[model samples]
Every structure is written in structure tokens, then in C-alpha cells.
Target: MALRTFLLLLLLLAAALLITQAQGIGSSASDCCLKHSQKAIPSGVVTSYRLQGPESGCLLDAVVFTTKRNRKICASPTDGTIQKLMQHLDKKAKNDKNKKKGQTQRPRGRAKKQRRQQV
Candidate 1:
């Protein structure tokens, strides 16, 4: 009876380990796309996107677009519409970044005090 109980415990432990390992794998792939979407995605709804491949831990090459609501849609990279949309998004991002950099930076601390003294 003692030996049987030990064996049962060991088996249970192995099962637990397997389940945890499987869950770990699933979590790692949680952001991965299992398949690509065939339906046309409205460009207006896309807020951002990213590319995925086998090296990126995905089984297929895909351009994953993030919708305004933060939903991810995987699309084929070779699609002309997808490519155009990616370019548009890229340009928008670049423009946004440039706009941020163009913002006026005021003098701080000693600089501000020196400017006040000068005036």
C-alpha cells in the first residue's frame, strides 16, 4: 500500500509538471497568430501593426495589425493592400515622432533664472 501510494503521487506530480509545461508553451504563444484572416480589414480601424515569422515565435509569416480596440488581425504580407496600409501606418508614425521632436523645449533651472536676470 505504501509503495502504491508513492507511485500514485509520482504519477500525479509528472502530470502536474506536464500540464504546467503545456500552459507555459500556450502563454508564450498567446500573442502568436494561429492563422491569417481572409476577410478584408478596414484600414481605418488599424491603429498599429507588427510582422511575425518563425524566428519571431510564429509558425507562419504574417503582418499582424492592431485595431483601434486593440484587436490583432493577422494578414498575408504579400497582399498589396496590406503593404500599402503598412506604409501608411509607418509614415504616420514617423510624422508623429517628428512632431514630438519639433516641440519647443523651454530652459530649465539655472537657465531660466539667468534668462530672468538678463531681462
Candidate 2:
């Protein structure tokens, strides 16, 4: 009975270790982003962008952009143009989120229509 109990405990320990390792591998894979390049891309060519901070595990802060050529580029955070673009994108995303939230919170009934009609 003691031998059987020991084997069961060992099996559970092995399963826990495997689960931990799997989670680590999955998180690390997701944490990685496109590697940064040194070549400069013209401001007019970038179509959209999002900022990734240091908490994202990247070597440095990066601005990931989609270009008119259908390419994704990672630019340096230190660049003034990239910084301004990121701020604009951040504000736009915030406004869009708030608009969606407001729409969802409205009552879906004749009462809402009546209230709107009164105003």
C-alpha cells in the first residue's frame, strides 16, 4: 500500500511539472513580437500602428505599424513621429471603446425610444 501511494504521489508531481512547463512555453511564445529593424519607413506610408510597452517583454518599447505596402514594421519608441502616432492611435482606440460601451449600455426597448423621442 505504501509503495502504491508513493507511485501515485510521484505521478501527480510529474503532471504538475508538465503543466507548469507547458504554460511557460505558451506565454513566452505569445510574448514575442516582430523583431525591430534599423531601416526607416516614411511616415506617409504607414497605415496604422499600435504601441507595445516594456511590460510586453520586448527588448525596448516598440511601435508596430502596418504599411501601405501590406507590411508590418516595428519602429523605435524614441522617434518623435512614432510617439505622436502611437498617442493618436491610443486616443482613437479609447474613444471607440467608450462609444461601443455606451451603445451596449442603452436599454433595448420602447422606453429607450420614448426617452429619445422626448429629447
**Per-residue accuracy of model 2 over 50-116 as CA lDDT, tens digit each:** 6677666555567778888888888887887767877776776799889888896856667633445
lDDT of each: 0.87, 0.74
In candidate 2, the residue pairs with backbone N, CA or C atoms under 3 Å apart (3 or more residues apart, or in different chains) clash, namely: none
What are the C-alpha RMSDs, in order, of all predicted structures?
6.5, 8.9
Residue 6 in candidate 2, Cα distance off native in Å = 7.5
Off by over 4 Å in 2: 2-24, 28-35, 87-119
Error of 2 at 62 (Å): 1.5
Clashing residue pairs in candidate 1 are: none
Question: How far off is residue 21 in model 2, in Å?
Answer: 3.2
TM-score of each: 0.65, 0.47
Local error of candidate 2 at residue 27 (angstroms): 1.5
Worst 10 residues of 2 by lDDT: 25-34
